[model samples]
Target: MAVTKRVVLHFPRRLVEQPVIYRLVKDYNLEFNILRASITAEPEEEGLLVLQLKGEQEEYDRGVKFLLKSGLKIQSLSQDVTRNEARCTSCGACVTLCPPGAFVVDPKTRQVNFDDEKCVACGLCIKACPPRAMEVHF
Candidate 1:
């Protein structure tokens, strides 16, 4: 069976410039989709990448092991972002700032819908929301 997972990866300063992501595809037979990344040429700070990985369960596990061995911190995507419907006004303010289109306005009800699966936890929506509805955990 195939498995897909979304995870936040933290790269140590020393490993920030490595070709590990390429290895995940070529060596592990895993597909990598980088949703968001913060990397710099300097090795002064740890870099972060939010990625979606897809492959067989075994291959995914192996790839995760490889990441762990390389001193990368892995975090699950669950609880990364949330929306309070009671506090939301469907103002569509967050729709423009969300890079992944996680927030959408329902055509029929004209209400805003929050899709957690599509959220990359970039935290831009939280500030864009006028009612302060979007909350980011990480």
Candidate 2:
């Protein structure tokens, strides 16, 4: 099983507007679960912004590289995932569409549960959902 991890990045308020974050998402496909992030200022230490990122291992490493290349400061990093479990109607839509087999339908209850570890964050299941239940977390 792949272990999920969280990475927190701290940056100056000026660096936050550099548009590098978008580039990372577009280029490397960084999956981010934002927990707590904001730009704050103090009397002595102003113009500082904090960003927290939670995602898979690959995303974490790439995000670090993206931040480093952009000249942003790294604050903290930890292993964690803020998962969003969605209800599955068991219409076999997710089963057929989910390439990673992240979704599984219970034979007894007809309910479906999605495993984030197994998921590659593909959006195919989202389109295949008849009830619009499956949501891809980035």
Candidate 3:
């Protein structure tokens, strides 16, 4: 039987919207539905982003593993702030480097706003960061 379960992915403030998540979905052939996702905290630059998801058991387990291997910090819905606020200096490295366009720079404020819905939680930004600002919330 295909058992379905509710899962919430608490993405770190950084690298929330990247290609790693999509890759996991496609690679595992998992059926997923996003329940809720947002920056749900203050100082968007240094806050926690929440991603609520529902999917099959096997697929979901694989998805969780995939996310872990990809370097994303995962947290159940019950646990909040699994990771810490990112101290990115808006270096613009992740902006162009992110394939899914997860990192965007505000030319006006030069602050980076990580969109969790768009993020796949790939660690490219984490590796690319010179200041080591991006944190993975697992």
Candidate 4:
């Protein structure tokens, strides 16, 4: 079966220049979508990458093992971005800011709806929410 997972990868200075993603694809036969990345050219700086990876379950496991052996610190992006219904005023502030379109406005009721499955935990909603209804649990 195929599986998809979001993960954060921290690359030490030594591995910053390596083609880790390329290896994941070529060697492990895994596909990835890079959500965000910050890697400086300076040799002294470390790199950070957020990715959504997909592959067969066994291939995914092998890819993870490869990452660990390559000296990358990996963390599952299981962080939750939640909305407090009580505090939510149905304002559509989050609708435009959410990268994944996790928030939508109900046309009939003019109420805002949130889909947790669509959230990517980018935290943009938390900062944009006027009522402080959005919360991030890391």
Candidate 5:
């Protein structure tokens, strides 16, 4: 069986410069789609990356375990973005900030389409939505 999961990874300073994604792809044979990233070798902060991994169930499980054993903080994501229909104006403000184009405007109806599958919980939509229609959890 095939499955995909979104998770947040926090890299310690020691592993900040490592090719973590490359390892996940080459060793685990997992497909990694980076949704959001701010990883850097900075003095004040740890590296952070939000991504979705796709592969066989067993491989996915082992890959997550490998990440944990490698000292990377891995938190599986539940739901990323949600929208309140009544509060939305379909103004398309969030379309620009969304990296994955999750918030798309339907040209036929001039309505906004909120595809949860495409969202990675980047949290940029929360501030970009003028009416605060979009909410982000974690």
Candidate 6:
């Protein structure tokens, strides 16, 4: 079965320069879409990467195992951020705060639309929402 999974990867300072992502494609036959990345060239600082990986279920599992063996800390990107429609007032408070533009206003309807797929669970919208419509769930 084919599967796609979003994940967060933590790279230790020592492994930051390695071609870890390349191995996923060449050895594991996985496809990846990078959502966000914060990598520092400094030798003392660690690197962080958020990405969606897609492949067969068996291949995905193998790729994840490779990441673990390479000393990378892995976390599921399952932090679900949702907006309560009843509590939302289309105030557009979260429109500007979202980093990925997950919230957008319909030009004609003047209503806010939430695209959950684009959200990175940054929690900025949750804090900016006046009606407390935005929420994050682990």
Each model's TM-score, in the order given? 0.77, 0.41, 0.42, 0.74, 0.69, 0.66
lDDT agreement of model 5 with the native: 0.84
Ranking by TM-score: 1, 4, 5, 6, 3, 2
By lDDT, the best candidate is 6
Please give, for residues 1-138, the per-residue lDDT of candidate 4 as tens digits.
999898878898888779999999999999999877888887777798888999999999999999999999887765556789999999798898888998989899999999876777777889799999999754
What is residue 90's positional error in candidate 4, in angstroms?
A: 5.0
Off by over 4 Å in 2: 1-3, 41-60, 79-138
Instruction: For each candidate in the order shown, give its overall lDDT on alpha carbons.
Output: 0.86, 0.56, 0.59, 0.86, 0.84, 0.87
Give the RMSD in angstroms, all C-alphas superposed, for model 4.
3.3
lDDT of 4: 0.86
The pairs that clash in candidate 6 are none
Q: Report the lDDT tens digits of candidate 3 across residue range 55-117.
A: 566777888887777566666543321223456666677788876687777889987766644
For 1-138, candidate 6 gives per-residue lDDT tens digits of: 999888888899888889999999999999999877888888787798888999999999999999999999898875566788999999898898889798989999999999877787777888789999988654
Model 1 scores worst on lDDT over the 10 consecutive residues at 36-45
Scanning candidate 2 in windows of ten residues, the lowest lDDT window is 76-85
Task: Rate residue 64 of model 1 by lDDT.
Answer: 96
- Model 1: lDDT equals 0.86
Candidate 3, superposed: residue stretches over 4 Å from native: 1-86
Q: Pick the candidate with the highest TM-score.
A: 1
Off by over 4 Å in 5: 79-115, 122-124, 133-138
lDDT by residue (tens digit), candidate 5, 1-138? 999888888888888878878988998899988777886657777888888899999988888888998899887764546788899999999988888788788889988888887778878889878999987644
